[model samples]
Target: GRQGSRSVPQIIDDWGDYGAGVGQVAASRMAYRYAWSTTLDLE
Candidate 1:
C-alpha cells in the first residue's frame, strides 16, 4: 500500500473547489473525458 501524498498547490489544483460558474463543470468534464478517451484510443 502506498501512502497518500499532496502539497497545498497540488491538492488545490486537483480539487477544483473554487467557484466554477455557468457551464464550467460540464465544459471541464467534457474536455477531460474527451481528451482522456482520445488519448486512450477510446474515441
Candidate 2:
C-alpha cells in the first residue's frame, strides 16, 4: 500500500502544473499520518 500510494504522487508530480498540488497533498498526508501515530503512541 505504501509503495502504491507513493507512486501515485510521483505520477501526479510528473504532470507539470499538478506537481505543486501533489506536493501539498503528500505533505498533508504525511502530517496526518504523523499526528495519527503520535495519538496512537499516547494511548
- Among all candidates shown, the one with the greatest TM-score: 2
Worst 10 residues of 1 by lDDT: 14-23
Q: Return the TM-score for each candidate structure.
A: 0.45, 0.60
- After superposing candidate 2 on the true structure, give the runs of residues whose Cα lies further than 4 Å from its correct spot: 1-16
Model 1 residue 18 CA deviation (Å) reads: 12
RMSD values for the candidates in order, in angstroms, are 11.9, 12.4
TM-score (C-alpha, index-matched) for candidate 2: 0.60
* Cα-lDDT of candidate 1: 0.74
The digit string of per-residue lDDT tens for model 2 on 1-43 reads 6654657676666786677788999999999999999999999
Write the residue-wise lDDT of candidate 1 on 1-43 in tens digits: 2478667887786566544543688898899999998999953
